[model samples]
Target: MSDPKLLLIDAHALIHRSYHAIERDLTSPSGEPTKAVYGFASTLLKVIKEQQPQYVIATFDAGKSFRAEQFAAYKANRPATPDDLKSQFARCQEFCRVLDIPVFALAGYEADDLIGTLSKQAEEKNLDTLILTGDRDTLQLVDAKTQVLMIMGSTGELKLYDDAAVRERFGFAPEQLIDFKALRGDASDNIPGIAGVGDKTATKLLQEFGSVEKIYHNLASVEGKVGEKIQAARAQVELNKQLVTIDRAAPVTLDVNAARFGEYERAPAVELLRELGFQSLLARLPGDGDGDAADLAAHAPQDIESKYAAVLSETDLAALVKRIKKNKAFV
Candidate 1:
């Protein structure tokens, strides 16, 4: 058999994506908002079914990250999490709990760091890791033993990025993504890299120089306005490297047995889904072996030949209507 695979989920990323993907008015029977919860659960179940991972772990953002401490303006550009969405985080955690999936959330580290730490540990155990997230920052962690399952927000498409795939998309190795971000900057997270350096310049610089430090070391060789921009933002680029790189040494321990998938109590999960008014999702639960479960199996992405495929099913359509009450919300 193939080596067992571990699925490391970026809970915050999926929760945030879910909040925006589905209508905000989706709620539980008692009127508590559940758009995020439903979307997260649906995506989580979809991944578990598609990947058939033997182990699974979900990571969440607990509080301010070290990036914020290092750069006061880090991620300062994003607005505050809405009150409705904030309340749904606990429900997502609860869903993970009911499924017996271990949830990790460190106060000073983002979910990305936790995933990095866990994937590194999983690698040492000779296990393959599949990181599922909407964040491109995690692409830096991709390698032979580790790959990223990226969810496209616009089309809700899933794309798997191996080392080769990363190079195909970014024109450099996955490890070089940090340097690319350091030179190009990420406006979403408020990471200010070298000013005026865009994607092409950044890619060209990294492809030629390999890294930020080396690029600066060979500064004399770099000429023109781009060179001046790099020289001017030397300190900022250095800081951005620290901000962009994921910390693989985070202070979280991985209990391999605890993360073993398919060992949870099905009754509790079934009840929780029912309580959350996720009736259509009830049959999709792992090991359900029911009517729609077989149908759900056929909808999983069969291979990696194509970067994107439609994984939705008739049951999903029915669920979308049951949850959002409007077909347009999914579109």
Candidate 2:
């Protein structure tokens, strides 16, 4: 059997990109701005149709990330979220609720951190994991069992990166992405790197010396003013490393079973889409758009009563063993 695929979405990244991509505002029936909502919904449907993942979770950014606490100016350059797009965040979240996907966010971490934590957990379970995000910083999370689907363009063009793809794109392995970003600095996040280093210079430095530490260690050997620039910004380079690294252990606790994707009622979902004026998405609902009660009933969340439980006593254990034996033929 094929390995189960878990699709982890960076909700904030998608919503922000979707909000900015369109020139004109999109509004719902009541005139609430909904371009972000519409864009997120469309992306979700497209991913579902194409990837057909068996497990899914959408993660949103928690308030201010710990980075902001560490460096007050972190991401300070960005303007406030546009009110129109900000208003649509809750609607997009509700759409996730209607679709029965677990929504996750922690108090002091960004969506990328949650994804990193879950990706680690999924790695332990040996599941195939895919991260969908517009943030390039998430490239650090790619590994043997994990892949990042970087969403590009208004149409959500996906650039899939495994370790090999990351290497091909950046001239280094996925593991070096954090270090590369640290040296280059992320202007979008207001990070400061060496004074004059750009992507080409950063790439060349990494390719030659492997990492920031090594470059500094052999500062004398590095030729040119770029080497002097690296020495001058040593403190910023170290700080940037801390800022760029994704914390895989982000104090997130997930009910792994609850996160497992399951069938959910199609009627309510379609109803929500219709209410949102998403006629284009109504056709993609699980069943025909006839609003059949039977279809809804058939797809109701699985009851916990039928699930196996821990045997706390010998008698319970004996009963459970017998039940397992009884079902052995089917297995």
Most lDDT-accurate candidate: 1
In candidate 2, which residue ranges exceed 4 Å CA deviation? Answer: 287-331
Q: Which residue pairs come into collision in candidate 2? A: none
Model 2 vs. true fold: TM: 0.84
**TM-score, each model?**
0.87, 0.84
Q: Report the CA-based lDDT of candidate 2 relative to the real structure.
A: 0.84
Candidate 2's residue-wise lDDT over 227-303, tens digit each?
Answer: 78888888888999999898899887656677776578776787787678776777665535565444445556776
Model 1: per-residue lDDT, tens digit, 275-294? Answer: 88887898888985564464
The parts of candidate 1 lying over 4 Å away from their true place are 290-331
Top TM-score prediction, candidate number: 1
Model 2 lDDT, residue 302, Cα: 75
